[model samples]
Target: MKKSLLFLFGLFSLWSFALINFKGVPVFSIVEAQQKTQPLTGKKVKTEKPVTIKRNAVTTVLPVAQYPLPKGSQWSYLDNGSDQGATGWNQLTFDNSAWAAGAAPLGYGDPVATTISYGPSSTNKYITSYFSRDIQIDLNTIGDEVEFGLRRDDGAIVYVNGVEVFRNNMPAGTVNYLTNSASIVDGADEKRYFTTYLPKSVFQNGVNRVSVEIHNRDQTSSDISFDMYIRDKAPDYVCVEDHIACFTSIAPTSQTPVMIIPQEHRFQMLFKQGTAYMDGSGTVPGNHDFTGYIPSVGATSSALGHLSVNHENNPGGVSIVDIALNQDPANPLWVVNNSRKVDFSNTALVKTERNCSGGVTPWGTIITAEEATTSGDSNGDGYQDVGWLVEINPATASVVNYGNGTHEKLWAMGRMNHENIVVSADGVTAYYGEDGGTHCTYKFVANTPNNFSSGTLYVLKMDLALSNDEPSSATATWVQVPNTTQAERNNVTTAAAALGGTNFNGVEDCEISPIDGKIYFASKGKNRVYRFKDNGTTVSEFETFVGGKSYPITTANGVVTENWADGNDNLAFDDHGNLWVVQDGGLNYIWVVRPNHTQSDPKVMIHSSMPAGSEPTGLTFTPDYKYGFFSVQHPSGSNQAQPDATQSNVIFNASAALVFSNKDFLGQQQNLSTNPVVALNSEIQVYPNPTKGLVTLSLNEEADKNLKIEVYDFLGRKVYAKETQTTGINQKETIDLSGFKGEQLVIIQVETGDTKQIYKVLKKDN
Candidate 1:
């Protein structure tokens, strides 16, 4: 005969049973156990396999509970500056009825709910302050571990149930009331919270006493602060995939449009405003605007790079973040390795303001545009120097030095309400637009290739008058502007108008088509995106590429008809020549226009709609085109949380930077069939023409034989040569041109078996 022994665990009673013989020996079974559902909670409980155990064996484990000590909780503190020594004042049995009670955080100097006395004199303040709180705990309902969130200045020591549990900033060995902190606490570290974990065994079954002693670095320390909270050591958020629709028919009015994406894609938040940096600096700034991604040198992984994010404020700042991909294959995630604020005060410009959209140079540097002009001249450079383009080294989070004791503001770029700038592949020409009410599109040609210190500025002058309300076309010439003097550069808008420069209403962004090498810019006030073919001196075939007309948008719900509203702001291109338009006005939608889109029959799709009271800005892609980054600027505080259920309690309601990509799109080569620049013969291609320091040679799949690449300068002098076997796919070979000087023409020859191709490339000095 056999007897059954049963056991139930915790509040969510899970049942398990074992069979025992009459002689008291347990019998194990391998049969599958069934699951039972609790009617009250509607939660399923899974049973474990029957095992051999004692007849009266029992086990208890409970789920983690909510935080026990919240901010501003009342605490009994002693601030009389007397040494309590090792007298059992921290024990539960100790009498503390005479101690003064106050709501935390309680200290001096910084903002606090309750301020405590700092002792006799300002020069001779007290060294330590004592704080204690009582909390009840149940052994059967508590978790295995607890975490303490402590905010202290200088140092602190914590005790649980009259036993030492953690020490921070204090010296090693026996600690007493006279102990001093290891170092001084200053700046942002004073307000930062430090966390520590301890086993729940330190707590008691009934009432538990928690005591903490905060010590200053020295007796004369100017400031002191203390606050603490306790919670179970379990993560509040459980990561889950957000499965949203690919498209929605509802427009954003009272609330933000629901984020929809392709079924295979995933969206993730990389950084949020007000998050503390890993280096103990202040939290990330708000009003996130321009986001630029710079891939690390020689980085084999597509996800390893640096991000330069601009804060659009009165005194603007740029934050540089070093990021990498996590190792989890099932759930790939991007992690921030380090982050800090870019130091612009060390430069001659002192500080930047209203940093809007920017561009990345081919030689690895970021150029941030100052979108506003100010009357104050911090640099005293005869004219207001706040509206020039500034360059930065994202890797070091510092402004580039010109080696002349000055810093990275390009004075030659002229002063205006700059919206965005785009550099050509050759690194010689740059196009930017003015975002004022009546402004003109401008161009810059560097005198020394990649060096933008001194450049010639020009404004667009169209031969035919272009219509602002309907589809129109025209030819234009770049008229040279008198930008040599500070006074002339200060008033470029007025001078350009005098020279008959075509006035565009709110020209917001400029981008070069990677497929056909054409220039495209968006006029926000006119609601049109105009494209132009750049010939050496003049532009031809200038016409409206998108907007200024009605188009059909396909969605998962159904086909929807819409017209371009007054919102087209920023523009970016993908590997497939698809244009991604980020909006700052109207419905604040992110629109994607295919390469084959025509004026009569446009192929456009709505990708995303920003949250209420917010506009999407700064959309940039990685080198492999596998990931994209953008910012949601100043979203409504009441907007719904995203991705996870616990996010509702988090701070994503503020501004944030996000990254999105699909697993199927990673590690794929560029599509050469649709790109005219790379599909001439579907064989070999050399770019960027007019090399600065290095040039890349790309070979197609048909080039499977032994490949020979040779570069010759003017007068037929062999400058560089290499021979290797081709992988027959998207194989790239880099040719170094740093040895050459000045601007000169060079011929790059590629021979694969019998097929040979020669490209006339211009090699420019760095």
Candidate 2:
């Protein structure tokens, strides 16, 4: 009977697993079960036929629906320079049977589907041209909101079902056939399509009429074009886990540009250029580039931190902002609390120029790289001081002040077209690269740990010959440069080159791999990323990690092809040790190279594509690795606007800072032990499993014993450990894991005297 019950239980479990449903229908079902009994022996036997279930078709309803009046559709047009008084011509009831018919766009002076006469002479053209189309709509098939994408040169007035809808570029009040456009159509705006929404109530159930009149800025405007498309107003994109694969690049248009991210990730625009600071210091500056996030002291909230943003302008400044995270699950957003700009007027280095890519030190300070160099000695210190690393205290939102009138500039590090710097975990060793022309990679070792005021600077010198045309490998060494005096430091670049420093082309960024502690940097001019094991005084296994060769890339349409031309620029590493390369010159694609990728067969994937006229800069991840921050610099103003994951309208037509993460993978909480009750002793409990930063441990039962708490990462690396005495019946302890990188699994071991228990916990970013 026990054996029979066990078999029945197995059948029940299988049935339970098969009952899981998608869209209210069971994905699979078990069928054909039989039981036979032996009468003489009074025994029962069971047998089942092979189970088969039909997979049901699942349908998806898109948020938007296009109307029949798509762009390039045939239209009835009148361009004979004849004036039909406004009323009769725009009404659906008025029939123009004699009007010439042609497929849009219909105009002159530019490419069009059908060329129309521009009046009698080239200098005296028609002022107005009328076009109309009939569209069929099913009320049940579309939403109540309707939108129109209209492209026109000079000016236009659109009417739907004889009702005036919208007017563009034309003066207010009454308009006639001879009315001129308010402004001349020129450059990109002339060919750009403007979008507007209207009520679906303007149309009947079946046939609807859309009429448009195009008017030139002047009688002899020299050009006129018009084209339009209509669709139900709804969201064009949705972020769903495993549902969408990727977002492709878009061209410059009047519409807003959308960010290209993995389909599963959710993107939010935290701040934009020109945003007013809460402190009233000033609005956020433009030409945004580098972004560094510094977690606040004892901060448990994922959103609460200091964010430093670099302005890459002639007179650049770093903006420090205080941010907080919203806890509402339905509307998770990072809120900017306050902001202020770093002051530099009082220091020897009166001002900073072209503040570009920078790094956050291990000891919680921001070091902004001054990318532009000047020959003038403004401080009269016998050395040019414009191009140097300036340290800022984010908490104070000002430059770190030394004694006298001097400020935060690291004079010993030398000057060049400094792109970015990366400090090692020890905070003593730093690596940086130059950004323009023929530059060299350099390293600096602080005389004392965590202090950059004094350091021994060295330039990289490789043994093997380096070439820009092909992949190169070599063993390298860091050769010391003469930096004992200010003049020597100012001319460090020249001295380094004299010491046989390998002249790498445009080294844009440098980063340290979390998995292996190797140094990686991007040579934008050479189109490659190189990695080397920094063995203190020497380097080993120096080779190109990615780029400089053809690698397979999957296009948005699912076609795989080889792409050899990539101008790799910025570099970042995720918790999983994947190197993310953001391109600046070629295709502007963000590529992800796996940790185990080999030079012979590089394992790379196209993660994202930037919009036209824009380059991605400053890619950095939070400690939990659940979120990342980056900037879209100098995108075309004509890029279209799109709705973000929260249904908020966002436009990337200008420089902006954005954050993104995988939606489904965010805010997940787990305990360390397989069974919390057994391992935690029932009396011990951990609250707020998926913590923003702070975690609390509570003990309810009475116990007088020595308690030890420890945390270990997946790699068995001890990240945190603490010990205390439990003197009372109830005890509580708070653990701060805000500084850990990426959303990761860590084991927590709790020991009370001879009894020890382990629990698995998931640390996340919000």
Candidate 3:
């Protein structure tokens, strides 16, 4: 499945003023003052020997302890000079009585409370350390949730009741004492806090053992820090399964063109989200040259009374534009007018980079994401830029500043290679996905609805081992991470890794179901889309909806003929509960899957297709479901655009905005008598007459009835014959003359009962 945001804080230190707050949950401290503290004392469990408790000198700080520290939340340690062979070190039954007892803040570097448990030993170089402790679990009085506050200088893996639960700053796969940690943890001077949450499912009726193994960056590492605190509270909400969706089977249609954007029209729209502001300073109202573009989001409706399009450009900057659209339901087409560029560069988006795909907020705004985690200091903010969720006000055509910096970065939402952001109907809880390998899914809970300025971010950790099945999973846990400032926010990825967030295969676009309130997200690299249940505070019921190795298909020359789609990028939901998915890879196709579709009655359909070398992006619908907007990006140049003879007056290319009328998408047709063809010969036309192998025959709606088509060589040999129905006016049918060798002329005949006609055409060799 996919994973989800939060900010950064200064390194973990004993400074009294360094205290931070989340809603009312104070940042747990290992060096709180006033001496109003207790030792690790609680119901003792079975061990070889009694547990030893240590008391250190306490400092006089402030009254910030909102929740009393849990008993036995501290740990005892042992330094590993070399590889400690596989043993029961993580189990409650493991005999660690011989280990030394020391209060937390146990390491050589940084400010500590009691003792330096390891390191600073020049000769006896220690590379890894071990820690274990036991905490009482009173099922009757304890809550269903547990939160942990940890500080590790390098990396560590945590366990509860002998079960391995979380790992941070560590490599994947089996790890041992000799195994070195991942990259050096980010920060200077002090250990940083890495927080996470665990459900009551990890606990039992009695005493549970908490164990940890801390690994150093290298043998010469000067510091190694480790500390933890735990508390239990009732879960805010629970998830129950309602409906599970599966990727519906779809048949790819050939050359069924919808719309096209030519290279000439690219300048009309802005570049991708971040690329527009590349030079650093450009007035919003000024017109400029544009080469290529990517569309990220599209919104339209009568309530909004206009159309909004998002440009997803990385090298320049992202932008949104407001346009007035005129559509005729009877004609099944629309036109763009009164286009106005949204001022993203002048406002908060001046620093946006790789502003990729995003989702629309319920409050009639767009939540554009900066796909780059490390955008250089674009705004000269001292801090490196990019990697943020920016809110845009479509109505005013500007960034939405909620007292934060321009283009509210939602710094409280943490930083990562953000792919998409979907807010809950309540507007307080938001779900996001990261677009990189081995990333985590996250959720942010605001202090109040529609006010995301301050909130708590949590990373999702699933118990996948509990069930081997890939899809239909219903269990996962959320761990809170710090998100108080921009710098702190930038450390979210590292914090989430430490919190044991599940590794996903490049999580992308996330959307919430209005019918069921479930959140759906895509793992593009894995070729699967997944959904989960969110209860505002905590989320559960994570499972894959569809797409995997099981759905087999192949792409040749920008065309896919299979009944499945891969590389699912953006997603949109129409009022009818139909999910429209936009593909990213070469075979740019838009697939529509019905919510209640089943195997016996498959309801998946190919809604549209982008031209060769392009992908359909920014799929969205108006509030009234009357019109849907999308963009076709990056059409290849050397190759011919090769318009579908079936579509009328369409140009598909880079950074082009297009729309589909709800009626046209539903296969509805206008009154045939209103626009009829009197003579078949006069209404029919052939394109590129002297063609190589392929040629198109465009027919008007009068040819809607079954017609017999035949082709003959110069020698009077019948080469081909077929009967088919015309879909609409200007319907195109491609005929291949490749098999007719040594032929310079061919006879083509069309016959439908009383109407029969023959025409001579020239065939050329490649």
Supply the global lDDT for candidate 2: 0.71
Candidate-wise lDDT, in order: 0.71, 0.71, 0.57
Residue-level lDDT of model 2, residues 640-695, one tens digit each, is 77766555777787888877766633333234355453555776887677766777
lDDT of 1 by residue, 16-66 (tens): 332212233222221211243422223343334311111222211111223
Query: Which ranges of candidate 2 are over 4 A from the true structure?
Result: 1-256, 299-301, 403-405, 468-473, 554-559, 562-564, 665-766
**Per-residue CA lDDT of candidate 3, range 1-766, in tens?**
1211121232233232322222232433322321223222222321122223322321221121223233222365766464554777778777665455544556675434334445556644577888777666666765567667566768888888678788878899987777888878643313334557677778676767778888888776766777666665322211111111112233454433333322111111222222233223442221111111112243324422444554555443434443443344343333333345555555234556666776666666777777787656666664456777877665555677886444556778877888787788778888888887336788888997887778999988763321122421244668888777776777888888887887776777778876567788877766666777765444554555555422222222333435454677887775545677777773567766666432222345555556566677777655545445666666544334343222433344344655444333222245645533225667677767887778788877554677778876643346788998756686888899887666487767776555666666888876
TM per candidate:
0.54, 0.56, 0.48
Q: Which regions of candidate 1 are displaced past 4 Å?
A: 1-258, 299-301, 468-472, 644-651, 663-766
Q: Count the backbone clashes (under 3 Å) in each candidate.
A: 0, 20, 38
The order by descending TM-score is: 2, 1, 3
RMSD to the hidden true structure, all candidates: 30.8, 27.7, 21.4
On a 0 to 100 scale, what is the lDDT of residue 500 in model 2? 84
